[model samples]
Target: MPATAYDAKGLLKSAIRGDDPVIYYEHKRLYRWIKEDLPEEDFTVPIGRAAMRKEGSDITVVSYGLMYHRSLEAVSALEKEGISAELIDMRTLSPWDREIIFESVRKTSRVVLVQESSKTGGVMAEVSAAITEEMFDYLDAPVTRVCGLDVPAIPFAPPMEHFFLPNADKIARTVKKVLEY
Candidate 1:
């Protein structure tokens, strides 16, 4: 199974203890993240469960790994404009928590998926398709994706890399567009 983890501690522990073989993809950017709120005793986040980062009524934003960090920034900025975005960090991709994702979509009626991969194909596409397929009736607007540029590879130069990858402004803009629909 292919799994992803945003939290430095909780999800890592869960993956280590799971019986199934897992290909865990650790985001390099998240390696330095320090979580000060962990429990005093050992704990583990369930393998198939996603952690809800924030709750809102206007829209749902789904992402994982480093993209989750970027989406959080965009969601916070949107909040200042009075657009509420519910954020979900998909802790595991293969066995993603559909119940949480579907419930959020049902309440918000709109969703914006973000990923660091190119716009052509990725986990974002799969999740977006699943939402449309299973919760089509609940949606007020079509599911939207805010992903990286469709380039062969990310640019080596720092400046171009900024443009190639999914960032906060891009995500915020896409969320606003979906909200306007």
Candidate 2:
């Protein structure tokens, strides 16, 4: 069997065992299947925590994994438009940074969650639910999420991948829309 086939089997096995929350990051690069890069040796990356990337009073953008990088790019674009967006990168999802999100939402009263997964039953839904449950009273505008369309995996083509995935420009537009709301 090929390596790709073997990897597919391993993923299925892991999912069945439910040993760990498998982080399935899709490849954006067309015509390639890239594996996640872990440290060369066994090392510790503190999970279930968050890092503050920016400080601002206007609005906060919270995301994890790929969306974290996309959110940063969106914030950079927002800055060019005179809207300083504070970004919080949630390194882990299960034990997300509720304190950071809550405080930021309370202070700014506005938030936009940027994610790469499909919106339906995706991470963005959980984030929106958390904010509304915990900080609804503090919100000035409704919480919003910018996520990919609920479509199947992209084809091994550059144009197809670009169309299927959420890009920085799309994220920036979403943030701007939320700010206007």
lDDT of 2 by residue, 1-181 (tens): 0112223344344444665665544324311543554335433334444667788778998876666667787888889889988898766566567888888898899998877778889877988999999888999899988887787764559887677777888888877887888
User: Which residue pairs of candidate 1 clash?
Assistant: none
Model 2 C-alpha lDDT versus the unseen true structure: 0.72
TM-score, each model? 0.92, 0.74
lDDT scores in order: 0.84, 0.72
Candidate 2 segments exceeding 4 Å error: 1-45
lDDT score at residue 152, model 2, on the 0-100 scale? 70
TM-score of 1: 0.92
lDDT of 1 by residue, 34-94 (tens): 3455568786777778889899999999998888888889999999999989999887888
What is the TM-score of candidate 2?
A: 0.74
